[model samples]
Each structure stands twice: as C-alpha cells, then as structure tokens.
Target: MHIAEGFLPVTHCVAWAAVATPFVAHGAVAVKKQLKAQPETKLLLAAAGAFSFVLSAIKIPSVTGSSSHPTGTALGAVLFKPPVMALLGTLVLFFQALLLAHGGITTLGANVFAMAIVGPWVAYGVWRASRGAGASMDLAVFLAALLGNLATYVVTATQLALAHHAQGLVQAWLTFMGLYAPTQVPIAVIEAIVTVLIVRALSKIAVPELQRLGFLPEPAQPVAQKVGI
Candidate 1:
C-alpha cells in the first residue's frame, strides 16, 4: 500500500518518521553484523531484496484511489529475520519513490512502518511459531506471507484513519479495512503462493545457502511439491 506524497497530515508524517528511525538504524546494524558473519550471503541478500522490490512495484488498482501489490517481505523475513528486511525495505521504498514514483518521500515513514517493520515482524512471528508447532514448510510459508500482507494493509488503514478520519478512529479503521479487504484478499493469496514458490526454488537451487541462513539443516531433504501460484 503505497501512500501518495503529501497525502498524510504533517503531524502524522513526522510522528511516523520519528518512530521508524530507530528500527531502520537497528536494521542497518543487524545487516552489517550478518555480512560480517556470513559474507557468502551477500548475493543472496541482493536477490532477496530484489524480490521484494520487484514484486511490490507491480501494483494492481484497488478501491477508489489506492492499489495493491505483494509486499514480498515474508520470504526474506523468514530466512534473514525482520531487522534486515526493515533495512532493505526502507531502501526499496526510497527507490520506488525515486524511480517508480509510487510512494513518496513525505509518506515514506508510514509506508515503511507498514511494509517494513510490522509486515516482516508479523510474518516472521507466524513463520517461527508455525515451525515451532511442527507445521509443514509450505503451511508456515503460506501463513506467513498471507498474514504479513494483511497486516501491512491493516497498519496502513490504521495510519490513514488516525491521520484523516472525520469520524472516530474505530469507524475510520473499519471503513478503510472494508475498502481494502476486497482486493487485498486475492492479492494476499497470490502473494503467499508466489512466496512459497520462490522459497521452494531457493530450497532446490540454493540448499547450501539455505543451510547457512538457518532455513534448513545441512542434512535436510527437499520438500518442494507441485504447488500452484
């Protein structure tokens, strides 16, 4: 959910910026630490970031004024964790502003909060929890990707409601959710399936890489079945 430039009130923009800054700082530090430990992952990191960037850019029109796209953060979050995704997501959003002219500078903080901070963390939580509960990789991946994208829109709706609602916050929240849920439901399913597909590919082509990233044990067997995206 890319928020257009100058759409949010100044106070909301400033508040969100202030809140998101520390997470970005932590993300950068975490990435540096990861690189120091696993230099081989540099290329993997690039590919993961590119996946998030490229998928999010293909927006599908939704509601009256906004559009939907796969956040694409869930896969990276599951592999690399949420902090690095936050850092990479910030750069992705900034690049989208500069190149695609989708989300804007003014609203970067809010967008980052939704897509980077909350989305990844939620997805990662679901992933870990599901895995801990002995869920299948496919099921964990699907839940992570699906719920993460939904969380992004939920947070965005909350931000919008807080900033612009003439009605009370609850009412505004409900309104925005109603507006986004229709298209977002299908989009979430599509994004989750795509994420599973990508992870399945990585598991096959990059088994060693996945082992190094702690996504799989060194002796793990392949689990990719015929999955429809």
Candidate 2:
C-alpha cells in the first residue's frame, strides 16, 4: 500500500526516512559486490527488479477505501538474499513514485522501509527456514512470498497507525489492519503462486543463472575409482 503524498505528518516522514537510510546504503554495497562477482547474473537481477515493479504497480481497490497491491519483493529476496532486494525494491518504489505517482517522494523512505527492507528480510528468513526444514523449493517460495506480502501490509498499517493515532494507538492499528486484511489476503496468495510459477519456469530455462545465484545446488563431481587397485 502506497501511503498518499502529504498523508503523513512532517515529523513522521522525517523519522521514517532517517530509520530507512542505513538499510538502503547497505543494499547499495551488496548490489555492487554481487554485480562484480557475478557479472553474468546482471540481466537476472534486472528481471527481478522488473518483476517487483510490475507486480507492485498494479494497484487494486481495497475494501477500506485505500488501495492494495502485490508486494513482489519475495523473488529477489529468495534469489539474491534480503540485502539485494532492499536496493532493488527501493529502486522500484522510486521509479513508481516518480513516474506513476503511485507513491510520493516524501514517503519514499517509509514505503521503502516497509516494502523493501522489512518485507524482503521477512521473506528471506521464511525461505531459509522452510528450506532448512526440508520443504520443497516450491513450498518455501510460496510461503516466503505469502508471508512477505502480508508483512509489508502489516508494517504499512503500523506506519499509518503511528502517524494518525489520535484515536489511541492500539485502536488505530486494529482499525487499519482490519481494513487491509480483506483485500490483502487474496492478493498475497496470488503473489505467492505467481512467484512459485516464475521460479519453476526459471528452473527449467535458466538453470545456469539459478545455479550461479545459488538457487540451484552445484553438480557434484565424480571421484576416480580403481586407481589404487
């Protein structure tokens, strides 16, 4: 959910921006290192960014009179890790704000914090944990995308509640959460399925790229036998 321009107070806007700065900065370094180390995956990285941008840009009408959209941050987070998505996600938000007026420049930091920073981290963690527990790649990706999308909304609701909490903080949060859940739930599931499909397709077609990104395990080498005999 892109908070409208000028919706948040100046103090809140500044506070969010300050909090989000370091993550974006770290993300910048991570991107540079990744590109230098694996130059071949540059196109793959661009595809991930495009996926996030296209999905997030398709705003849907929410039951709360606000809008809801898919937070497509999970794919990049799962592929390149959370830090990489942090930068790509921010770039997606920046361009959306500038060109589409989907979000505003003033609230860029808050949007980035929710959609880029927290969402990717949550997705990456879920993906890692699910895989560690022996979940299939499809299952892990599905769970990661679903939870990550929901987490973004939860954080956005928190930000809104904090900014406009004259009616008591807890009440405000509950109200916002209630309004968002109706639309966001189905969208999250859809995003999860879409992510899984994309990953599945990539598994077949982009095997080398996925292996380079560590999405696929490297092939094991055979050992020489009978030499001693």
lDDT of 2: 0.93
For each candidate, give its TM-score against the true structure. 0.94, 0.96
Best by TM-score: 2
At residue 72, give the lDDT of candidate 1.
Answer: 93
Among all windows of 10 consecutive residues in model 2, the one with the lowest summed lDDT is 220-229
Q: Among all windows of ten consecutive residues in candidate 1, which has the lowest summed lDDT?
A: 220-229
Model 2 lDDT per residue over 73-166, tens place: 9999999998998889889999999999999899999999999999999999999999999999999999999999999999999999999999
Q: Candidate 1: TM-score?
A: 0.94
- lDDT string for model 1 (22-111, tens) is 999999999999999999888889888999999899899886556888899998899999999999999999999989998999999999
